[model samples]
Target: MAAQSNAATAGTATVQGLLSELAALEDPQVRAVNERHGDDHGVNLGQLRAIAKRVKPQPALARELWATGDTAARLLSVLISRPKAFTAGELDAMVRQGPVPKVNDWLVNYVVKKSPHAQVLRPAWLADPDPVVAASGWALTSERVVKSPDGLDVDHLLAEIAEHMATAPQRLQWAMNHCLAQIGIELPEHRAQALDIGARLGVLKDHPTPPNCTSPYAPLWIKEILRRREAG
Candidate 1:
């Protein structure tokens, strides 16, 4: 086990060196990688994303990257590299990482680049004791419903969400807006759950409005989903 840890560390070092070098390269692709790694090489996170492209989908990185990404350095390991899948053990660790707007950033990273570890990110993310992490879990749960409808359990997930609404209203409200922004997010059951939450919150009437949208991206979508809920 110690040897494996060493190997992982060595792999990370190698990747880091490669990324640093990649960062200095003039090529567009290399610069993009640098930008996402926080290398401000005249490119924004959005643009670098278009170029770096994740090597695989998530669940693979759950063990190596997702669970351990709390540290900026560790997260950087993933910015330049990704695991193929998440082990059962890593899921528990991911629960410890506080979810927030940055959590969404990683998801976008995993999604844009295509990490195989996306599967394990949420169940673990939401179960976290931290409301922020739970908010992140909610973020992806909403995304999963859209991108992979057959993949999630809306009823159970929402029940858990309702638990958040009761206990962590701030986080719950923040997640609500995130759910709205993802237009193509298409899990029918999950979408229904989001709408249900919106109706209860009365976003249209400008009442309390499903907790305050703490994250910048949450508002637009929160309003949109509420509109959809009312229209339907």
Candidate 2:
């Protein structure tokens, strides 16, 4: 185990060094935008990705940065992290720490859902008491359903949306709403069910939408996205 111990030590030192390098590259303007998104460390995605490419994939670095680094560092850590390095327990703890929704979104999309560990955590997270965890679970599930809807019980997903979309916490309601939209866009047979659920919730129906973007009011968003997909 001496070789293993040495490797671990070297890994930690390397990641720590990279974190320092990353901190020096921070931008005040980017940090301002990040603060608006609920994380304060103002690092832009392009800069972080460039640095991540230099550091390459390092789960050890990712974990250390996430636990101790600033918001920008943590974002970079997630981008560089190996999906296999994060355990379900670790993810649970991180989610419970009340990370900003944007950070959680990236972590869920880029790390948790991409890992094999997702299958083990999905059910637990969907039913978790923490609203964020539950939201994340739904978000990940929506992605899965969109990518590969075959063999998945689309009926169950639609039923869940109908049951929870109306009353879920704000974050969770958004994810559930997205799930409904995904069903409508991706599953031809279940499009009607999804549209019906969207109609029932009417979630964000009155929310002002940007001029060039489709409204995220589920039914309209689903139709617009599907149309875009077909045109592409």
Candidate 3:
């Protein structure tokens, strides 16, 4: 019991030190993140990565930091978290607690999908009524389709996209559209079908495209990414 108490105290000190580093690095002028995610600590990805490297992976400390931290600290917590340390209930609470869309993206991609527990949680998240949960589900689906589409019901996924893409909450719509783009790009058998859905829905049509990047309009996005891959 003494050993355990000592370990807990050590973890708390480590997390506190990390939080101090983040606060020291915070830049109030980094308002672009605030515009994009409604939260910003002025810490860039590079700084986050550097801090993550310093702290290493301390999943226990991560949970403590997340519980008491602000947006940037939460981001740091996720960066240093180990997927194996969390239960499904804990993951669910973390997702809800980190409500910003950018944070959700990080949690789904960096934490949940990488966890051994992903398969057990994916379907439940998809079926959840919460928009963020459903969006995380779609993000998981997107990762699955890209990495392994073997047993996935292509028809069912397409049907879901066609039916719900228009009315899905903003974050979910982004994810669902990602599903459409992934289908069109990754699975040859589904490409034509995904393209058809894109043409019909005109997903994100007129969303501005940067000079070098492809547009997010689904059909064009899918086609361009595929073309680039082929060229490379």
TM-score of each: 0.47, 0.84, 0.89
Error of 2 at 116 (Å): 1.0
lDDT (tens digit, per residue) of candidate 2 on 1-232: 3322322333343555655555666788887877776777655677677767766787776787788746666787788888888778988777776468667888898888888778778778888878899898888788888776666677877787788778887888888888888889888888887887888778899989989988999889988998888899
Score each candidate by Cα lDDT. 0.47, 0.76, 0.80
Which is the winner by lDDT between candidate 1 and candidate 2? 2
Candidate 1 per-residue C-alpha lDDT over 1-232 given as tens digits, one digit per residue, 9 for 90 to 100? 3322332333233333323433433366654665574443332444334323432223333334334443332334345444334343443344344233444456434442254555566676667666655666677666676667574555666565445453455655656445543422344435555555645544433434357542233334555556667899
Clashing pairs in 3: none
Better of 1 and 2 by TM-score: 2
CA shift at 136, candidate 3, in angstroms? 0.7
Identify the leading candidate in terms of lDDT: 3
Model 1: runs farther than 4 Å from truth? 1-75, 85-88, 91-104, 107-117, 166-172, 176-196, 203-232
Cα lDDT of model 3 by residue, 72-143, tens digit: 778878888998888988888888777776677788888998888887788888888898888898888888
Q: How would the candidate models be sorted by TM-score, starting from the highest?
A: 3, 2, 1
Strongest candidate by TM-score: 3
